[model samples]
Target: MQILDTYLTKAIANNDTRIPWGSLKYLIGEVMYGGQAIDNFDRRVLRTYMNEYMGDFIFDTFQPFYFHHSPDVSYYIPTTQVDAQQQGLPMKEMCLGISR
Candidate 1:
């Protein structure tokens, strides 16, 4: 979990948009399915931080693939930020995986 936290922080700091969303979804699913667990506070904090970090994109873009267990969430990019030259948007494509 610490590794996940560190990687998440670095990804956010570097504006890495290539996150492996499938992996993250798997981790969250595991936590939800009783395959793994985290302290409630940790889960809440991570969710809140991620929600804030990604803004509305979390729901508008990522949520669909997230619900489907797919790693591709870049398709939902906001029109204003869709230009290929964008920096942060690229990093947003990368989803973080949870390490066992």
Candidate 2:
């Protein structure tokens, strides 16, 4: 959880919505869960946690992230958890409000 918190901070600071394959693999496969040697099952569980829970609380722009993996790589991108209408404010409104 702490590792994910740290990475979340970095991701927010970097405004990075697209996390690469290597980073996710390292975080979940090696660094997390007592650093135990993990297999496919562990990976799926971690991925699900990120998708279902972590996604709800991460950065506003990048909220609802999930692992998108292929045969060779894994990545995280924004999920379709909430529709655009449900978001806080539109980009235009936010920009206009910022001028105040």
Best by TM-score: 2
Off by over 4 Å in 2: 38-100
* Index of the highest-lDDT prediction: 2
What C-alpha lDDT values do all the predictions have? 0.51, 0.53
- Full-model lDDT, candidate 1: 0.51
- Please provide TM-scores, in order, for all candidate models, with all chains considered together: 0.26, 0.34
Candidate 2's displacement at residue 18, Å, is 1.3
The RMSD (Cα, Å) of candidate 1 is 13.1
lDDT of model 2, residue 50:
44
Q: Where in model 1 is the C-alpha error above 4 Å?
A: 31-58, 61-100
Worst 10 residues of 2 by lDDT: 91-100
**Each candidate: how many clashes?**
14, 0
Please provide, for model 1 over 49-81, each residue's C-alpha lDDT reduced to its tens digit, 9 standing for 90 to 100.
Answer: 445444334546435323113555433434464
**Candidate 2 lDDT, tens digit per residue, 27-90?**
7655775345367786676565545434334455644333334575434443464455246333
Query: What TM-score does candidate 1 reach?
Result: 0.26
